[model samples]
Target: MANEQTSRKVAIIGTGVIGNGWITRFLANGFDVVAFDPADGAETRARQSIDHAWESVEQLGLHEDASRDRLTFVSSLEEAVLDADLIQENVPERTELKQNVLAEIDQFAKPTAIIGSSTSGIKPTELQEKMKYPERFVVAHPFNPVYLLPLVEIVGGEETTKEFEQQAYAFYESASMKPMIIENEIEGFVADRLMEALWREALHLVNDGIATTEEVDKAITYGAGLRWAQMGPFMTFHLAGGQEGMRHMLKQFGPALKLPWTKLEAPELTEELQERVIAGCETHAGDRSVAELERQRNEFLVKLIDLVEDYWP
Candidate 1:
C-alpha cells in the first residue's frame, strides 16, 4: 500500500546483510530510505535482499507507504545522509574504519539527526570517539534479518546523552521493534555474552567429540529454544519451580552450579575442526545454498513472528 511520502527518512550507510535488514525494516514501516556503500555491487545486493524480504514483509503486513520504489541508493555518503532524519551506520566492525566513517557521517548529516551504528562488537564509546557531535551518536545494533527480529540493543558512549538514547528508543519502537537500552558500556553488551557462553560450550562439545552439530541444534530447538521463544530463561525457570516459582527452584538447584558440568572457554578452532563443523552443517542443510537458507529462514521468521507476537511481555 504505497502512498504519499513520510518524513521518517533513514540513511543506511552500508548494504551488507545486516544493512539490508535495516533497510527492509525501515521500508516496511513506510520510511523513505537513502542507502550508500563504497563496495562494488552493494546497491544491487541490498535491493535484491529487500525484494526477497519485502515478499515476506508483504505477507505479514505493509505500511501505507511501504514500497520498493521508496529506496534511493545514493553514490556518496554525503548525499545519502544529507536529508535523513536518522543515519544508521552498518560498516565493518573495525574500530579505525568505523571512527573514520562515523566522523564523515557526523560532518555531513544534520546536527539533530541521530547517527546510529550497527556495531555488535565495538562499544559505542569507542565508535563515537572520532565523531564531532558524539552526543548524537548511539549504538543501534540489530540481529541478522533485522526486519524480522524485534530486539535492537541501544548503548550509549561516554559522550552519548540520555536524550539521544531515548530518541533511538522512540524511533525503533515506531518501527515495530523492541529497543533494549543498556546503561553500561561493556563489550558484547548483553545477548552476545549469553549466546557466547552457549556457543563456547557447543564448540567444546564438538571439540571433545561428544556431540555433532546436529545434536547441538536439536538440544536447543527441542528443549530450551521453545521456551525462549515466548519468555526469557529467567521467566521460564521461574515457572519451572512448581508453585513456589524461582525461589524454590533456585534453592533446590543452586548447589549444583558448583559442579564441573560445563565449559565456558571456547575450544581452539583448528582447521580440521572447522572443516568438520562445516561438513556437519552442510549435512544438516542438505543441498541448500547460503542464499536459499537465508530465504527459508526469512520466510519462517515472517510466519513465526506473526504467530508468536501476541505472547510478548
Candidate 2:
C-alpha cells in the first residue's frame, strides 16, 4: 500500500547498513528517497545492498509504485534534505558526530520536516539540543534489518511537540511499521535496554568458561528465542504460570529474583576472551559467508513474520 500520509519524500543522510535498509523500506512502500553520503563508492554499496535485500522485501510484498529507480543519490546533505518531508540521520554513533550532522540537517531541511535520528542509545534531548527546530526532532531508534522489522521506538525530547510525535507515528505507520511512542526519554530507549541486559549475561557466560559463544546462542535459539518470537518475555512468563497467568507466576517465581542467577555487568573483552568468542562463532558458522547467513536469516524472517502477524495483539 502507498503512504496515505502527506510525506511521500524521505531523505537519508548516511548510506550505511541502517540507511540502506531504510531506503529499501521506503521504496518498498512507494516513497521517493534521496540519499547523501560522502564516502567513495557509497552509492555502489547501497545499490548492492538494496539489490541483495530486494528478494526478501518482494516476498514480504511491495506497493504498486515501489521501485529501486525511485532512489536518488545526491551530492550533499543540503541537496538531499532541501525538499524532503522527513529526514533520517544514520551517521556514525559518536555523540559529537551525530550532534554536528543533525545540526546541519536541521539547518538544511524544511522547517516542517520531521528530523529522526537512528540512535540506539543516545537520548533525544541530547541529540536535539543542537537543532534550531528541536521541536521537530525525535529519536527514531529501529532494530537491525530496518526494512523487515516493524517496531520503531519513537522517543521525544524536552523540545519535541506532541503534534510532531503524532505525525511521526502516522508517517512510520504509513510504511507498515509498528511505531511505539516511548513516553519518557532514556539512554538505549526500551528494546535495546532489554537486549543489553541479556547481552551482559551472555558475555559473562562466555567469559566465565561456563559456555561457548555457540552454546550460549543455542540456549536462546532453541529455547527463549522461540518463545520471545511469539509472545515476548512478559506474556511468555504469564503463560508459564499456567491457568492463573502472571499473578500466579509472581507468587511461584518472584523469590528467585534474589538468587543472583544472572550477571548484569558485562565481562571485560580481554584479548583471550575475544579470540575465544571469535573462534566459537567462526566454528559454528562453518564456512558460510556473512552474506549467505544474512540471506538465510532474511528468508526465515519473511516466513516467520507471516505467521507472527496472525498472533500479534
Candidate 3:
C-alpha cells in the first residue's frame, strides 16, 4: 500500500473551509495540489489561507520540498481531478450533491486514485452509492485546521475493500497524520457523535439558563478536555476504578447512564436562543480576530500533539 511516487498529486474538489484545510496539509507534505471551487476569488483566498497557515505548519515541521508554489487552483471540478492520483472532496453535505459530485469525480479521477470525502456525518454507503468504482472510496474525515491536527478517522462503506482502507491510511500517513480506521460503518462515526452529544447538552444548558458559555468552555478545557487529549474515556474510567479496573468501574458509575441529568435532544434554535449563543461566543472571543484565534489554536494543538506522542509512544 506504499505510494511509489516521490510527490503525489492531490485534487481538492470543493474549496470551502475544509477543502482549503486539506490543501494546506497536502502542500505542507510536498504534494502538488489542484483545487477547484466555483466561488469568485477562490484561488487568491486559498493562497492567502496557505500563507497564513504555513508558518504554523512549518513550526510543526514541514516536508523538505513543501511550498505554496506546489498548489494550482483550477477552473472546474473536471480540471481539478483529471490527472490527480488522490482526490479529497469537500463540497456541501447534502446527500444528492455529494453523490453527484462523487460520481463526477469517479469519472474524471484516474482509476487508481482513491477518493475520500471530508464529510462530518454523511455515510460512505450513501456517498458511494452512485459511484462506478465504490471500492476506491472511503471517508477521510479530519478535524478543522487539518494541517495542525493529527487525527483523521477513516471509515469505509460496504463495498470498500480492506486493501483500499490500508491504502487510504497510508495516503494520510504520508502527511504524518494519525489515521484511525473505523472497523464498522456507524452513523456519525465516533468523535462526531461524542461532540454532537456534548453540543446538544451544552445547548440545553444555555437554553435553560443553567450555565453560561464560559462555564461550558471551562467545564471542558479545564476538565475532561485535558484528560481526553492523551487518554480516552474508557481508559480514564479504568484508572478511576482505582486498581479494580474497568469491570469494577462499570459497576460503579454505569447506573448514572440512566439518570435524567442530561438531555440529548437539541433545543429549539429560536432567534432569542441564537442571539444568546452568538453573544456568549463573541464575549468569549473578545478582541481576538478569527485569524488570530486560528493561529493560537494551531500553535497549541501542535504542542499538545507532540506531548501526546511522548506519553503514548
Candidate 4:
C-alpha cells in the first residue's frame, strides 16, 4: 500500500469545474487526492464529478488497477495542503483572491511541495508575490476535461527556479501529460489566445449574419476541425502542398495574404447578442442536461484519443 502511495499526492484548493477536473485527472493517474472547497455541497459535487470523470477514464482504458480508495475531502485548505507533494489551485480567477489563498496555504505546506495554479490569465508572478516561498510556485494550466486532454502549459514565475519548473514538467509527464514550458508570461498563454482569436471572428461572423451558430459548428466540426485534431493548421497546410511542403504552399498562397483578413476584433457583449448566443447554444445542445452532455463529450474524447494513438503511433 505504501509503494502504491508513492506515485504522488495532490491537493486541490477549490472544487469548482476546473478543480473537479483536476481531481479527476490526478486520481485517474493513480495520485492520492485531497481537496478543500468552501462552497456549499462542494465536496459532494466534486465527488460526483470525479466519479463521472473516472468512468470516462476507465472507458478510455487508463489506469485500470488504481482503485478510488486514495481520495479524501477536507473542509479546510490547510488540511488539504499540509502533506501534499503538489498543491494544484483552481480558485476563482481573481488576483487578490488567489493571493490571499496562496499566502495561507504557504504557511502549512511542506517546503519542498510544488504549487501550481490553474489560472488561465493571471501570471504566476502575480500569484507568487503573496507566497512566503515563491520559488515553489508556478502556473500549470490545463485544458478543460483535463483527464482526457494531455497538454499542460508550465509557466514559471518571478522567483520560480528552473529546477522547480523542470520538476513540474516531469510530474506532468509522469501523469502522461504533454507539458509545454512557457518561455514567458502572457495573457491567456498560447492555446487560449489562438482560441480567442477564432472566437472573436466567430462572433463577428454571427453578428454580421454571415452564418448561424449551428452553421459555424458544422463548418469546423465537419471540416477544418477534423484535420486540426490530427495536425495543426500549419502542418495541415504543409501537407496540402503535396511534395512542395510549407514553403511552396506559403509562396503560392502568399499573394492572397494581401486580401482583407479577419479584423480580429472582439464583439461587444450586448444584451441582445448575449441572449442570442445563449439561445443558440441551447438550441444546439437541445435538452441534454450538463451531465448528459459531459458523458457524450467524454465518450467522443475517448474515441478521438484512441484513433489518434493508433494512427499516430
Top candidate (lDDT): 2
TM-score of decoy 1: 0.83
Q: How many clashing residue pairs, candidate 3?
A: 0
Predicted structure 4, TM vs. truth: 0.81
Candidate 4 local lDDT, residue 30 = 74
lDDT of 4 at 240: 55
Winning candidate number (TM-score)? 2
lDDT of candidate 1 at residue 133, scale 0 to 100? 93
| Lowest lDDT 10-residue stretch of candidate 2 | 274-283
Global fold similarity of model 2 (TM-score): 0.84
The better-scoring model by lDDT among 3 and 4 is: 3
TM-score attained by model 3? 0.81
Q: What overall lDDT goes with each candidate model?
A: 0.82, 0.85, 0.82, 0.80
Residue 293 displacement (Å), model 2:
33
- lDDT score for residue 116 of model 3: 98
| Candidate that beats the other on TM-score, 1 or 4, i.e. the better one | 1
Candidate 3 segments whose C-alpha is farther than 4 A from its true place: 1-7, 264-313
- Identify the runs in model 1 with alpha carbons over 4 angstroms from their true place: 1-7, 265-313
Candidate 4: count of backbone clashes, pairs at least 3 residues apart or interchain: 0
RMSD vs true structure, all candidates: 12.3, 12.1, 12.2, 12.2
